[model samples]
Target: MNRLGVQLGSLPWLVLVTGLCITGLWSHQQRSYRQLEHERVERDLAGAISQALTSRLQSTIGVLDAVVGLFDASSAVTRAEFHEFYMALNRRGDTLKGIQGIGYAAVVPNNNVEAFQQQVRASGQPDFTVKPAGTRALTTAILFLQPNDWRNQRALGFDMYSEITRRDAMQLAASTGEPTLSGPVRLLQENSIRPQVGALIYQAIYGQPDRAFNSGQDRRNRLRGWAYSPLRMDDLINGALATINNPALIGTSVLVYDSDRTKPNNLLFDNLNLAGSNKLTHPTWLDVTIANRTWVIGIQLDHRSLNPQGWSNALLLQALLGASLSVLASVITRQLISNHQAVRLALSKEQEVSKERALAGTVFDSSPLAIVVTDPNGVIVQVNQAFCQLTGYSELEAQGNKTNLLRSGRHDSNFYEQMWAAILNKGYWTGEIWNRHRNGQIIRHELSITAVLDPQKNVSNFVGLLRDVSERYAQQEQMRFLATHDQLTGLANRTLLIEELTRSLALARRQRHGVGLLFLDLNNFKPVNDRYGHSTGDALLTAVGQRLLSSVRESDTLCRQGGDEFVLLVPDAPELKQLVAMAHKLVQLLEQPFNELANGAGSIQVSASIGVARWPDHAHDADSLIEAADTAMYQAKHQGGDAIATASSNATL
Candidate 1:
């Protein structure tokens, strides 16, 4: 009964539960490993596909770079010269796999369009004209597209800049002098029967090839044409994947979208028709940014390896093995517990008697009262936990010492003599006494002593109990302080102000001197509080109170009259002139920015409108003096604040 005797009866329950937990944990770890391995595969396969697609698209930009270079080195490139250069580069065609073809467009000014057409016709294409072009401000005419295929011939003479998508890309290329990609578009060469989403990469070729262009504006000023390659999105993604040597993607389907969102219109390529399929599990998504365009690539790995059914038989076997172990463990534990039952019952009865004695000893040591027991001659014998705490002495330190070891020296010999006299005469003593703690602090205690007597009525030992009362006395003082002061500012409140004023006035009347009162109202304080929350406002008010304290005499009483208003009572003033000068000084100090609140509150600037009044000069008593000063403070506020207004005529200082 002392400690439930370890409840050896739960041996069976403990073993059974532990075995089951081990079984469940083992199964969980296996599944988690399988899941994690599958996710790793998905991530790697998807990442590789995305990287290959991005690399392939980036590779196609090199063809456009080659066209830009040809124009850069030449004074002029005729249609035949451009065709010859492009043919030499495209002979192998492996690097430019996804590009339909590369071409150059000529920039034609609207004012000189007719002249440009005539010049182009004169150069060999006598029938060439800018197609669908009429009074365009400017045009990039596709003058030469090769390998001169039927699709290439159809686009020649078309104004590429007339289209918004192409114009935006060409404009970007011209201004930035970088290869740029167009957003999703349909190429002009695409047939109606098999139209596909398309994009274009463009590189600007400036007319003043030998002239170095320093800025975008300068580049635009000398812009000649563009070297561009049109793209078929489906072919582009396929070409990118074909370049990847990673064999992990053998059973995977790669789908590429124009951007990150997976929508029908944005879908560029779906290799295995996986876009509309729901059977794919754990699809991995990747984003590839290529030439200022973003494409989202999704890869789905074969889920056959992830089929949990493949391991169902293994898990079933594990469950049966766990059940067998649990049954064997329970059977063995039951026999062991039964064998120990008789021996444990005997030990429990023997433990009960020893525990009772220990319990009694524990209660004595743990008592809240500082208890001490000593022989009739007063040699120390024992002390409790409370005694150690109250006097800062451990039981080991106090056991062999006399009771006088605690005497604080605050009481004279007569105090101890009286305490002993009462104890010996009446066999008891009770009184408040002072003792010195081990740490050299004086502690007050309410002490009581009684003599324990034998059958013959002779004293055998004395028992003393004491309770520490120092905290109770200190708390009384704290309560008094709280009642008379503002807790936040630690300044005297209105109650203390009245008391101090009454006493100061009586002295002033006998001494024939004046007392000054300044009532201050912080200008627009509500707005400040509203602007920066109450906590900051409270901090500002406390700072103001301390600032006023720093500039005042120690005898002066400063009080927070409530809100942002405060009152300072100067007991003995030199004159009305000095008092007003003090008021102005306070105003100046307050107007300076508060550095304490600068970290979060910014530069906080506060000003005070102070109303100054004097004893017998403004009014007779404390309340009347405060009222007169408050009225003058309002007058100061009306005069735009940050100034002093006194009750004395005009009241300006």
Candidate 2:
């Protein structure tokens, strides 16, 4: 009786052991399967994001290229040209914000003698009533045919001989003879009311016979006026943002900065912060440099917002299948208990564990998330294929090496110290990191590191998971650019200018230094717009923006304060004379005739006014400084458009 009882106990014990083994194998298999599914999903998500961003960038580049081509073809720079160019752009009208305006600057005959002779011989008077080339309305200014009246339009006849800013831009263009994009600048004419102007500039090539001049001393080949176009905040930039495909998936923000003082705080564009679930939020930003402008584009998405229901359903279905399979196997084992039970059960559990491990390994290796395991010393013990792909290294090359092999050199030792400290304290750390690939290319990565503890609660190993974030960085850069830069001329927009001005004010107050502000209004830009159209106006604006950028010191700020007005912020000026000199230089540059085509025909002309104000001496704060400059600018305009006026003497506070 005792032996029979002992035998029963042993049988039950054996059965219990076999069940435990089978259950362990089943759990391992399920975990492996789930991990594989997660990895595949992550890879698909990463690929989708990359494709979306690439498409957006490519589209933007294409549009810019088309705009440049249009600027090169015409000299008239009119509305008709703008319409034609817009049609050529091929972007849907609802999608486009309209081709604004174009203009250019060039050298023309300055001889009053020749002008009078031509006027006497010609029909009554060459019609100087400038009208928008294609449209009857939107007239802005008139031109006089009389020789004396032509004085304002003279290129060489005037004393703009010493203007520095204009001369510099022209010189730069003449020397390089290549199309150059200028930093953001405010339009001079729009100084009175509007607070910003953005323009795009193109250098004119003038060797054509139609642009030939009679005087050997004529410097016609010198810097020609720029082909320019202006951009409005709600129009070009905002419109572009609204068109972003899957805006829910890709949250974007832009920041534009101007290295100037007079007009400092310019916020170009920002479309960040959206509400949604399942979105991957990308807080990382990247810098994109174009010409002299630097823009930051930031992107974010909520991972939870992206089809969470689908993932949940998949998980539920997987669990249900796993449970059903486990139950069926358990029942089968019980039924076959008497026939080869020991061998079948043992093999089944072992096979299941092996299959689970294989599945898990395969999933991990093919995952988009880079996975790496290291011993306590930080020497890599194992790396997945994704890790190899991210670092541009092969599995064989990465194993047994240190994680530092992929260091990009962008971060200092202190950075690593902080990272390690966080991981040690919290057991895990998550952040963005800069790393290098095998090809020496710097790459951004979203990284999570965990400290694996042993039975004694001592750190035994480290595991790191990384996802390449280069695309997200690029998107962030694009956002920053849209926010602070003028889309038209690529100058610092009003928002950026204000920020610079505020900073300049703080610096000036601390150093007790003087800052100067110059307000500019194009003397006859309106006539150019009316006669030639927006296309010509745009070309002119682009050229003007370039000229403004060239005229200032590297320390100064040039901004588009809207319409035909522009502002210059000169920090740490020694005296008012320096300010006057800059103002005069700007005036002189504008005095040069803008050579442009009319209805695809040969060249036409334009000019501008300048106003100067000094900080503390003229007024206080950004607003007052701007006001003083505006008052002086109008005074200069009243005295005759092609001149400069100082705020201290011209306006009463």
Q: What is the C-alpha RMSD of each candidate to the true structure, in Å?
A: 30.0, 19.1
Candidate 2 CA-lDDT value = 0.58
Top candidate on TM-score is 2
- Give the poorly placed runs of model 2, Cα more than 4 Å off: 1-305, 312-363, 412-414, 510-512, 530-532, 571-574, 589-606, 651-653
Candidate 2 per-residue C-alpha lDDT over 450-549 given as tens digits, one digit per residue, 9 for 90 to 100: 9999999999999999988788789777766777778668888766777888889889999999888888887777667667666667677878889779
List model 1 lDDT by residue over 36-128, tens digit each.
766677677777777776676667788778788888889688988986686466434255545667888888855477888899999999878
What is residue 133's positional error in candidate 1, in angstroms?
3.4
TM-score of 2: 0.51
